[model samples]
Target: MKLKNLRYSCRHCNTEVGSIPFASAEEVIRELQRAEEGNGEHFLEYDDNGSMTVRCICEQCEQSLRMNPDYYALRKWIQ
Candidate 1:
């Protein structure tokens, strides 16, 4: 099997945010590898650049990002 670079979708919000900034497919994979088979609590999205937009979301995260636009960093999920 190949350790392919994967695009991750936000578990909370359906947005396009990848993981180039986080670096390494392994780095992203490690975060949610233990949740379950095919159930990644976190994810990485992709842009036209082939870069990724990483996202990890629980119910709290969804509510936090949605309720407070002030959390500009969280805008990643809202997208």
Candidate 2:
């Protein structure tokens, strides 16, 4: 399964765009389920379908998102 987004907005840069992200619905569901279960502590917002709906910026944006694993877990808790 492949996950593609027709539109996305960068979480940091707010750049809205149509882009094809790393494709894998199985991976996404697994990751989401993991996070939702509070068992996964890695953050790859770009690696998921919901977040992929927002365009991921370039390597420069990597700095901003790299430290958010805990935040991701918190988000899952809230969700």
Please name the candidate that would achieve the greatest lDDT relative to the true structure: 1
- Put down candidate 2 lDDT per residue, 1-79, tens digits, no spaces: 3445334445555555444344535465455546645743332344455444433454545554575555544423222
Candidate 1 has an lDDT of: 0.51
TM-score of 1: 0.32
RMSD of each: 8.1, 9.0
Candidate 1 residue lDDT tens string, 3-77: 345564456565544433334666655554543346542343445654444455556666786788677564344
lDDT of 2 at 71: 52
Worst 10 residues of 1 by lDDT: 14-23
Candidate 2 wrong stretches, greater than 4 Å? 1-9, 16-23, 39-57, 63-79
Which residue pairs clash in candidate 1? 8-44, 17-45, 17-53, 18-52, 18-53, 18-54, 19-52, 19-53
TM-score for each candidate, following the candidate numbering: 0.32, 0.29
Q: What is the lDDT for 49 in model 1? A: 54
Candidate 1 residue runs with Cα over 4 Å from true position: 11-13, 21-23, 37-79
